[model samples]
Target: MLIRLKELRLERGYSMTQAARKIFSHPDTYNRYEKGIREIPLDCLITLAKLYDCSLDYLAGVSDQPRKYGR
Candidate 1:
């Protein structure tokens, strides 16, 4: 989970601060999510999936496919 979040953010060339702003969160809080220090909320996870153009299953490490179904 931690690796996927950071990887997606980096793949998009988004700074932690920038990503946090997009998700309406504080940078420190967002950093915690990336570091696996805090549990991510469902809404945030959904937002991230959309923001990163990946499926929730991929973000959750349940699947290797990044693109969402029917995309």
Candidate 2:
């Protein structure tokens, strides 16, 4: 999940600050999340999924598919 987050962010050309801004989070918090130093809140996770156009399952490492629908 942590790897997925960083990969997606890099794939989309989003710096940590930009990704944080997308989810209205502090840079430090976002950095912690990306580094697996802190657990991400549910709501924040949901927002990240939306921002990355992925599913919670994917972000949580329950699924390899990023998109829920896979359309």
Candidate 3:
């Protein structure tokens, strides 16, 4: 889960600040979510899903198998 989020951020060349802005969240809060210091809320997850163009299952580490959204 941590690795995947970091991977996605790096793959997109997004700094924490930039990603936070894009997701309408504060950088510190987002950092906590990434660091597992705090549980990510469902709404936050949904925001990240849209921002990263990924499925919720992937972010939640529910599955590695990829599935495109709206398929």
Candidate 4:
């Protein structure tokens, strides 16, 4: 999941700091989320979904489909 987030961020040319700003999270905390060292909350998940145009299911690794559906 963290790897997926990292990949998406990199693909969008966003640095960790930039992503944190977009998500309204602290940069270091966002880094931990991306590293999987800390679990992300549901609210944060939803925010990330909006920011990245991805579904929570995809970020949670609950869906194998290319795009997440039916949260």
Q: RMSD of each candidate?
A: 0.7, 1.0, 1.5, 2.1
Residue 16 accuracy (lDDT) in model 3: 95
* Decoy 4 TM-score against native: 0.88
Candidate 4 — which residues are off by over 4 angstroms? 68-71
* lDDT tens readout by residue for model 2, 1-71: 99999999999999999999999999999999999999999999999999999999999999888997755
- Local accuracy of candidate 4 as per-residue lDDT tens digits, 5-45: 99888889999999999999999999999988899998998
Report the C-alpha displacement of residue 64, candidate 1, in angstroms.
0.3
Task: Show where candidate 3 strays beyond 4 Å.
Answer: 69-71
Between prediction 1 and prediction 2, which has the larger TM-score? 1
TM-score of 2: 0.95
List lDDT for all candidates, in order: 0.95, 0.95, 0.83, 0.86
Ranking by TM-score: 1, 2, 4, 3
Provide TM-scores for the models: 0.96, 0.95, 0.88, 0.88
**How close to the true structure is residue 48 of candidate 1, measured as C-alpha lDDT?**
92
Query: Model 2, clash count?
Result: 0
Candidate 1 Cα misplacement greater than 4 A, ranges: none
lDDT of 3 by residue, 1-71 (tens): 77788788988999999998998889998898889898888998888878888888898888784354666
- Against the correct fold, how does model 1 do in TM-score? 0.96
Worst 10 residues of 3 by lDDT: 62-71
The model with the greatest TM-score is: 1
lDDT of 1 by residue, 1-71 (tens): 78999999999999999999999999999999999999999999999998999999999999999999996
Which model is ahead, 1 or 3, in terms of TM-score?
Answer: 1
Give the C-alpha lDDT of model 3.
Answer: 0.83
Provide backbone clash counts, one per model. 0, 0, 0, 0
